[model samples]
Target chain A: MCLAVPGKIISIDATDPLMRTGKVNFGGIVKEINLAYVPEAEVGNYVIVHVGFAISIVDEDEANRVFEYLREMDELAELEDETSS
Target chain B: MARQITIEPVTRAEGHGKVTIFLDDDGYVRDAQFHVTQIRGFEKFCEGRPFYEMPSLMARICGICPVSHLVASAKACDQLMAVQIPETAEYLRRVMNLAQLIQSHALSFFHLASPDFLLGLDSDPATRNIFGLMQSHPNIARDGIMLRKFGQQIIELLGGKRIHPGWIVPGGVSEPLSVDKRDTILAMLPEAMAAIQRTLDWFKRTFDQYPEEIRTFANFPSLFMGLTNDKGELVHYEGRLRFVDATGKIVADQIEAEDYQKYIGEAVEPYSFLKFPYYKPMGYPEGIYRVGPLARLNLINFVGTPLADAEWAEFRELGRGAVLSSFHYHCARLIEILNGIERIEHILNKSDILDKNVRAYADPNRLEGVGISEAPRGTLIHHYRINEDGIITYANLIIATGHNNLAMNRGVLQVAKHFVKGDQLQEGMLNRVEAVIRAYDPCLSCSTHAVGQMPLHVELVNRDGRVVDELTR
Candidate 1:
């Protein structure tokens, strides 16, 4: 599974932004997301998006938790040795 | 430390990608990563543009699958317009879609996926190409080029140009299907059907040699998604979304195309620009599903055409219920080509298909609307909320490839685990990875806009600074 990355939002504007909605930057790439679902979200908060919809609120801590889980799972042999030996 | 084998540009596929496989000292499988490097932000760029321009602009996304983007983008615009298109217009669109299926499938089987099947997977890299196939089986190469051309010609006749035709519009097509042009297309159906039959016969002769390939290596159980008629018949132009398990049992059937958001959700990964989409209720990897020709074949009981329906039966009897062999993706394409021919013949024969009242009228007043269609690859949904004046306020495109992203990653990993041995990485291993990609026949241009000018970096990086291994294709 591809985990959602944490990119600090650089800005959000109310004007005629990229898609008439606000445009948010994920560091390098700027993605245009629908505002209907998250009309209350601000420019600074991280949002988890898929197919251009912000589905959930994502913080740095939650993003880190996802990474930690993957890191633990990556050490497949270590876990196998601990269990079998 | 382990030795890393990196294959850059993951050859014989649609987009630019790389595969990295790690092997431990004793030659045991460690890990694998398939990285897609390009990011074409069509959705971001498409913002603020007139909705009508999307069909033309999005068509330029991929040279190979421009028809798919054109169709989906036009259909989305049509939804926003809220116009009842004429019956003839619908049939014209169907003709275009069927043509697209034929050509795109030909490109996949003949050009991209053929090398593995024709020349054994272990064949020498330098000689394992279309030319290599031409060295022995010259007839197949000629057949592929012609069959693919017939598909392109169908698009040209209707849309004014083959690659990225701009004829399909928000209300309806820009023009009607002309009598002369329709006759020309009708004349070619027999030849196209003959070509498909020849290719299928060739596949049948040599298919048994690759039993291991037919069983695993990108072949696994997953939910299948495709557009089917309300009666559960195979449909390309208009239908509801149907989901079936690997066993061919209905999981969630009769999903209306307009109400797309209720069941689908998208997820992102840090490693690639592509997004993973799954069934919302099932969640994440477990909810992961497969789309495109193989999935379409799996989800439907009978193809619309008589010939294709018969082949569908022969395919199921092979014990791969809803055939899972990545290799049979070629077989599925042939079946679709046959179906496309039959569908085109059926549509052209309809007098209303060429009726003069092609365009419809709509106010384009809706602030929010969703358009969904079965792209040749899979289910494509374009959801947009427009301003009062019909200017697009927001856009969300759930591309077919995006829906298949999880399956692609898993297939790559599975193939790596199955074929890549510890001591050495064989040519077959690399072919298997490419095979997974070929199964989807993805148009990365349509998924993301094409960033053709920039060079991409594909290297195996360890935790330390050293670059372990890499080969640029």
Candidate 2:
């Protein structure tokens, strides 16, 4: 199964009430994702996306925890590269 | 009430699907449906985003074949910018795409399809899985694991990480391939090749055992479609779309990727979220065509590699014109894995593969752009229309799984009629029905991950062990 990471919704398209869409930033890479399932989702809210649909809106605390883990991964990669060099 | 049989989350494939078999009053099969219960609109969400992020964004479509989406989506973005990617980048992308095909096909063959072949379809449901294959055929299991690992490792080497590698970008790859990485991938090819060759040989021998399945499981005439090289040789990463009729005559020729919507028309069904795409001229059900490995092999002149070409010849011998049996799709998939590795090996040995110039920087130059490539499953196209600011206004993705929707439905019905008996359903009967769908390897997540869970409908099995009615919870 593909892992659905929680990315922050930076923008939302409300042109259609029933089918909502949003721009989500997974760190730097921004993707416009469907927010139809998560009608409550707004700009700055974090949601976990699978395929193109936002399955669930992640809480700020849980989203932060995942982000912290990601940062640690980046740091670990840097450490490994430095050691290898 | 007629006996209704439902198999949920059709095992071994990437995503979820359910097979519903409705039995007639006399215990004959009435109708069977391959329902895509999940749908995440990849196209709906991609609107209003910059074209450059498409490759990475679309890669999320399927973890099983992310590189397929990455390459195809990148090509669309490249078209959006109206600039040709550097030659080295194209070569590098081709290598990555092949690696993806190898890895994804390995999962299909080794992880998903092999259990049915190695372990008999009649085997215990709990025991008829990869784990069962391990307990029974340890050496083959290890080889399968190692083969998939080699492909994944190569992907990691080039794209930086195995799953959802963001290295593939709009203009080109994010970085150049390191010589060390190339050498490492080359060294592993031989072992991978040997493993697949062994598996292929074993599968060919096993083919004779399942005469019933070969003859009945989606074994019928349907138009075949795929990408082909300039001279009409089998090409995966890029080429013109070609469609061959059941009699192996060219029905459609040299159709450009951008003009796909003109010829390919999508039809919606109430049962499955996956669209049934058919050739426009034929219209609706009559226009139904199959795509992916079997279709690719059926539509092509040759596989364009040594090891796979040998297998392709044998595969073509399965039928007169186009191999109608979807069981042969399993055969075509394994051959493709072999070809993928060989092609990647050939690419690594080339000189310009190491060229530092990979990306071509450009702003959006066109309002509309379409990109097409062969995913591990079949032909994939990503069409995008951008606004003046380069933000995507509209997008349409025709996935390989959806392309096989018509054939998959047909396979389900055929297998249900052939296998399912009475109200007393055996586990193997359901497995066989699911296997028919697996033959096409439908990735429901990639196809239509639309809605999460549907309302629970309780199915009541009677004293006679038959599902007579469904009660809504």
Candidate 3:
């Protein structure tokens, strides 16, 4: 079983030059998220997304760590190659 | 206690839900659970509010279908207020409902369901979504986007802002449908209709390709529920509840919207926050029934609109008496798109559609009220009890998805039992489960808005209670 939840942001737009927004991939669906709420956020960040709105920001390391843990347990079915045969 | 899996904060719809597929000792499917993850205390919240305030307050329920809630809540309030709204108001309300129908059906089909259909079930997960759809079918995606925009534009012209427009009040709308706006909306109708027609033609001609998808995808038998006028016409607003069996025979007729409690009963489960509503007469589990587009199409013989009628005939020919497959819900919605165009055309021709006599002010002297209307998904009912001081004492909201709870669960289990096999998880099998939810288009934010997000943790344990692995995303 795999899950999707909200995480906080350690930094905003850590990788992107776009300061107003950055990229966050939820289960591999990367969407450019707005940094209106947490202007202080930088690279390696997380946030709860709903209908294109970022309800809250999450931690990047925590989110990656969760994915790693899920990957170890085989609960997180890597969607990276879901389309690829 | 058993093998478990969880997808927290499921997306592509209004709110949130999780699907849990249970496996038996022999690796056979046990039961599949689709749990609605959110719960709002709206009913309890309305307990102490005034009757007239319902239309506006209930409008806040779901940003997607607030009009449905507003219409239902206002109708119920009208019943208590005992004031007859003008005929012109009724016509305007119908126009609003049709506008909502056009946009909402467009969103569900083009934005949500079409990705699954056009992308191919087994396609790459990353590319199988809306982004991929944009790349592949740019025109088709554009049609959906434009069509939905038109619908929202209609609502904005008639109500106010796109979502949760506060135009429809108890007696009538807060204002009249302007002639200039009507004319402008009418101007775009032809292009919109053409776009919809193009997509419809494509789907109809290529129907054969989706045989496997149409046949076994949520194609289980269940009862149909919807609203019908006294003349037994397709009634979206102010009508009685009608239930029909799989054989297309009326199981119950003339069931008043106010007395829905007499026939519907809600069942609770330990795993999910959303309640499973069942047919009170048949009881839980066995009383499972379907609502929404699939159910609505099953209940109606024809949509009456010319283009829609043509598509409806094809839909019936494809699925027969009732299309049980959730995949066909997308098809049904397209048909409604045609129907909405025809309905809009008829309304536009009527002079009363833009009459200034829209609002009918009524004294809020009643202690209790009920509002009921056929939401695009299914029947939506809002019941409120207010004290003499004009404060609410009790409230009950029967949303479109809530009405189809039993049927949704049944569809999920049916798909799980049929497609899910062994320990191996297949994308096709998972899509089937998601397809079932798509059929109802359940709005979790509308259903429940108060609860904080809960973490979904699923574990598959062996006989010795050893956790071989844990998956958390």
Query: Per-prediction TM-score, please?
Result: 0.78, 0.79, 0.80
Per-residue lDDT for B157-268 in model 2, tens only?
Answer: 8876334578999899889998899899889988998999898888899888999989988998999999997788889877899999998899888999888988899998
Q: Can you tell me the CAPRI class of model 2?
A: incorrect
TM-score of chain A of each: 0.55, 0.77, 0.46
Candidate topping lDDT:
2
Candidates 2 and 3 compared: the better one by DockQ is: 2
**Per-residue lDDT value at B411 in model 3:** 74
Question: Could you tell me the lDDT of residue B245 within candidate 3?
Answer: 81
Every model's DockQ, to 2 decimals?
A: 0.02, 0.05, 0.04
Top candidate by TM-score: 3
Winner of 1 and 3 under TM-score: 3
How does model 1 fare in lDDT?
Answer: 0.66
Better of 2 and 3 by lDDT: 2
- Candidate 2, superposed: residue stretches over 4 Å from native: A1-85, B1-15, B23-27, B445-473
Candidate 2's residue-wise lDDT over A1-85, tens digit each?
Answer: 2224567899998885434677887655576675644667789987765444564565686566545544544465456568789
Candidate 1 residues lying further than 4 Å off, grouped into runs, are A1-85, B1-15, B22-27, B444-468
Query: What would the per-residue lDDT of candidate 3 be over residues B1-473, giving only the tens digit for each residue?
Result: 12233433444322455566667787666666666655334355456557777776555434456677778888888877778998888877887887788777876776557777788766654456556676788788778767776776787788874234668887887887777988998898999999999999887776678887777666777888888766665668766788888777888888876688898888888976567888889887888788777777888756767777777777887655676777777878888878888888788889768788877776767776667788888787787777777677888777777777666767777777777666655555666666667666666431111111112222333334444333321
lDDT of 1 by residue, B1-473 (tens): 12223222321112456666665555555666666654434355456767776676555433345567677777777778877778788788888888888876775677556766788766765566554665677778668767877887788788773335667777778798778998999998898888999998888788788888877757877888988887777788787888888888888887876667777888777876677788887988689788888788888867878888888788777645567666676787788888888889988998677788888877775666666777767777777777777776687888777888888777877887787654455555665676666577655421111111111223344444345654443
True contacts reproduced, candidate 1: 0.00
